[model samples]
Target: MTDLTGLTIAEARDGLAKKEFTATELTTSYIKAIDSADELNAFITKTPEKALEMAAASDARLSKGEGGALEGIPLGIKDLYCTKGVGAYACSHILDGFKPEYESTVTQNLWDAGAVMLGKLNMDEFAMGSANETSYFGPVKNPWRAKGESVDRVPGGSSGGSAAAVAARLCAAATASDTGGSIRQPAAFTGTVGIKPTYGRCSRWGMVAFASSLDQAGPIARTVRDAAIMLKSMASVDAKDTTSVNLPVPDYEAALTGNIKGMKIGIPKEYRVDGMPEEVEANWQQGINWLKEAGAEIVEISLPMTKYALPAYYIVAPAEASSNLARYDGVKYGLRVNGDDIIDMYEKTRAAGFGSEVKRRILIGTYVLSAGYYDAYYLRAQKIRTLIKQDFDKAFETVDTILTPATPSAAFELNKVVTDPVEMYLNDIFTVTVNMAGLPGITVPAGQNDKGLPLGLQLIGKAFDEETLFRTAGVLEQAAGIMDAPAKWW
Candidate 1:
């Protein structure tokens, strides 16, 4: 055996069932890799003991001919999702000691499918920042290394650790959440494939709230096929989450027949932002050209409300985050920087526990939802959100999918734009719209930059149309193929 590090979860399961490798061996290898790759700081908590136990159970199930899609496959879960009896920090200091009594719906679904957890991956505290530098534990390092570049670039945010781990072969695949650009940005940065399904597709029952309206959980993996398999296990309706719709989950994997001979893909004009790198634009055009060559009709479409998406998302998401994160008071089961009075205690705890970016978001959120500003900010954002969704709804009327740049550029060096909050916010421009409209989107490694860093292209689909998204992405992915670069391509 060459080693199980690079295999996908589905491939690993098949191998495990065939007795090609034992789960114990595979999980142990990941534990070793996690330890060895300490420079990345990708994981907040690496749990080899839990992984071994889960692997043992999976092997038992396989012996009984009951192995699931992820039987014994190790996954690095993003810290935002709540895990039972284990630390589920949202990468925030305030939630330092907070352990959920129940598992998040997404986590539970993966667990029920027999996925072995490697550990909790790091993220921006409460998914607030773009760079992984905002994490309380430390910033996650991009596994890629470009020649002549001595500095380590960020792996991308919120799900940065997940992408870096998978890229570094620390785990086969990892579970990630996408509120803004979290999953896709990190995946792009680390040269992995990540999909963000339509909002409400995956149950958010126990996911530690970031931005309630936009928060969604998805899978980050090395290949689109693997992503499709994991996504299938993730999408389910849970009664516990009121936002979850009662729609039948699609057979996403089956949709990957590798045939897109008669699909209509829309190219949104609004995505051509000013000052975008020529290479990124070229990558997007190449992706479109490739898909067109695969027999898909390419149509240029206009999404007029696109510019409003970022601004609207900023208002609505932060507003909801302020409300959702308010529970982390001193009375709750988390860290508390004590003070003399109750209000003082609350203020001190929040001021001490939260990072600067988190506090900034909270302040912005509070102001948007505060007295007399609701109509101008929150209400207006809601209207724009509807318009964004409507634009997609209308576009889908003429096309099966949409094509755009996942980000304006490739991954940045650590702390390159962290000091400029506005610059960091611009990174989410291409991604936040999908969340606002509650549509499924995906990021695939399209091409590399001049310096050999991975450049990602995005595919957007209709509501509950993850099947189309995955199938289309799979077709495009087959055309794009793997990004094989030297270790120095970072």
Candidate 2:
């Protein structure tokens, strides 16, 4: 029995290098685990034969003494990332049958590092929903039960499948995207560590764009070090993306130190909103105390314009998404619906392809970006976004990292939030600021709420300083320990 569940990528790589397990054995175990976890609805498409073939090649390379760090390490690439010859559908009716010839930089980078592709996981349509229930394929059920409950609950979205799959050991890790908490939210919900690297740290080329300015690729894995290893492998410079940075990539796995001596952690005073749950607040305060015990200095700070982040992001992200998604007419790519005329074709195509929430965002975005309203809305949001970034800049000058809740409330019931659009958007209250600032942010499993569902403490870092963010998160994760909330879901 290959029982390497919850093993970090670094651990797996070393074991593979030592010939403790052949790539074929590892891939076979994971394929079986994924098959067994079908009730979770975590996968949209799987490539078992392709995975085994890749594993055999990796085994040969190891035999020839030419194996790479990630040779044959199976990874679940989120459906949003384009994999060559693999379905790159975004769990939407829109991009049905969409397969891209070119590999997304993130996917290509992972392939270059020698990871075997397990399959594409499911997600919310256009990455719009807070819960995975909005995915066209179906919701990703949390692998853990809700406290003492019996019913299978949803893992968060739109990277819900990746989080659930990783938690359940379906893949060693998953490549997930975070625009407004897609990666972090699901990670928190499923008791896994997920990171959203600084904007452009991982190239966006080949990633199906949801919100161009905010969408960034990152790793979702079991442990902090595992995430670090996978993140290093997935990041690279690409000529295809205009925003790509040509900077040297860091050895993230090599940078892990379990010590946080003299590290300054800032606690934003304003994040203690009036409406916060008592248990959540206590968990956060406990996390602050844990960092203090870990030899970190806790300082009070303020991100004054934080209140505007959610509204601003809702406006800006949708505006960008609206423009980017305009290209998906039924004629060119994806699901097509015929109509009587050209205008009718466009309308019919969109109606058939886009989910209701996606359509709602498109309408909101179009309205906000309308010529008469651009200055009043879109431009103002842009200016606010700049201010949000500036707030982080000023705060980072005083502290090495900022700590906040990953989400305002723990994972809510399915569709409990979907009825009210604003309520659902508010689920991202604690996460949107990091994206707005274009800085690195990570969710560390903090503790459970009174209901005892998992909660995560978020740490924000300087631009491109995912090193610091992970280092700090690794410290917290070890101290806070694993979430025991809802065990039956597993």
Candidate 3:
């Protein structure tokens, strides 16, 4: 039989429907593929036994012609999401051996739709870093390497493992979240499609919190259609999450009609940051040409508040993160260290549990939210966030969606910028604005950089308008052609 591991979710679904292959066979293929690709370090935990069990159940459902939308499809769950009886540590040492008794709403939805679990994918600790390097599990290696270079490139993060696993065909697609560009940036680096739906599009109940206001869950897949399919199953309103929107989740896959006739696409002038690589700029222009050719009227628009987005995001996200992560003080669960007293124990546990990057953000957050600094830092950042939303709101009034580069550059070597936190944070320059504004955004693989590394173009849509993003991204994906899989060295 053809390599079952290489089939997209759509193809596998059709094949399973026709009884071309049993779900267990497909699951077995992925299990073997993942076993062979260990060098990528994408999965922090492997659940082959559980996966086969799930796939066997899916096979039963399929045989009865009662399978759900994602029946028999295998997916990699990000470690941040809780899976009952499975480790869900968010790739942080602090949450060592944390196997939640409950499942995350997102993963539960996927299973409800018949999706099979491949295992937990790695991510940055608490989803705090721009690159995967900060993960206690170690950085995820991007499958794509620069031309003639031996250095392993980062897959991008904190959704790095999700992107890499999809790119490497370890799973059909994977669940990923974005807070300041975690999903889209890594998708760009690994030549996959990732979407950060409008804030509250997916329930955040069981996903480990980083920034409550900014974190949104979505999918990273090999194709835009696969992403659309995954998002349909992953998104739902939950009473457990008060922030989840009550609007009906549309058929995102059906939105990809590949027809964008007369749609107005906005080109934000502010996204043209200084010192951007020429290839990224060229790819942006190329996307513009493609959209124009597809009958989209390209309009140059200004989001003046864009300049403040990164700084404002840093303030607001860390502030919320500081508050959210305080629950992990070693008193309840996970890693704990005994101390002279309660205060000493709290100090020692946190000091030993948190990584440097997580500590840095927590410190920044605490500093910003402190008594004197609240108004000057956190409050001001919140105001800037409002202005940034207003900027996007104003632009959306004229254009159906806005376009930008997914990242400042393609994947860089691991540890290249780990030394400079500012440089590391800059990786999210093109992505944080969407989070601040609570808008839906997607990144589609567009072209390869000079180093032969993949680059992606981003499309941002109005609040709760992921349909437009999927539609526009379909057009771009078609125009760009299929990206070639990286030459496997592992």
The candidate maximizing lDDT is 3
Better of 1 and 2 by TM-score: 1
**Candidate 1 structure quality by residue, lDDT tens digits, 1-490:** 7767867776787788789988888898889888888888889998888899998998899889998877888899999888988898889888888878989898889999889999999988888877788889989889986656777888888889889989998888988889988999888888899999888889998888888888899999998888988988988999999898889887788988878889999999999999999999999989999999989999999899999998898899889988988998877678888789999999998888889888888899999999899999999999999999899999999999999999888888886745568888999999998999888899999878889789899999988888888888887788888765237222
Candidate 1 — what's its lDDT? 0.87
Model 3 score (lDDT): 0.94
Which runs in model 2 stand beyond 4 Å of their true positions?
A: 450-452, 482-490
Question: Looking at model 1, which ten-residue stretch has the lowest summed lDDT?
Answer: 481-490
lDDT of 2 by residue, 1-490 (tens): 4486545687788888888889899999999888888888899999999999998999999899888768879999899988888888899998899988888888888877889999999999889888888788978888876656766767888899999898888999999999999999988888889999999888998888899989999989888888898888888888888787878889887667888999999999979888898878888989899889999999999999999999999999999989998998888888888889888988899998888889999999999999999999999999999999999999989999999988877777754535577977877989999999888899978877666678888999999888888889888988987543234343
List the global CA lDDT of all models.
0.87, 0.87, 0.94
> Can you write out model 3's per-residue Cα lDDT over 1-490, one digit (the tens) per residue?
9999889999999999999999999999999999999999999999999999999999999988999999999999999999999999999888997889999999999999999999999999999887788899888899999999989989999999999999999999999999999999999999999999999999999999999999999999999999999999999999999999999999999999999999999999988989999999999999999999999999999999999999999999999999999998888889898999999999999999999999999999999999999999999999999999999889989999998999999888876845568888899999999999999999999989888999999999999989999999999999999787788998
Which parts of model 3 have CA positions greater than 4 angstroms off?
Answer: none
Best by TM-score: 3
RMSD of 2: 1.5
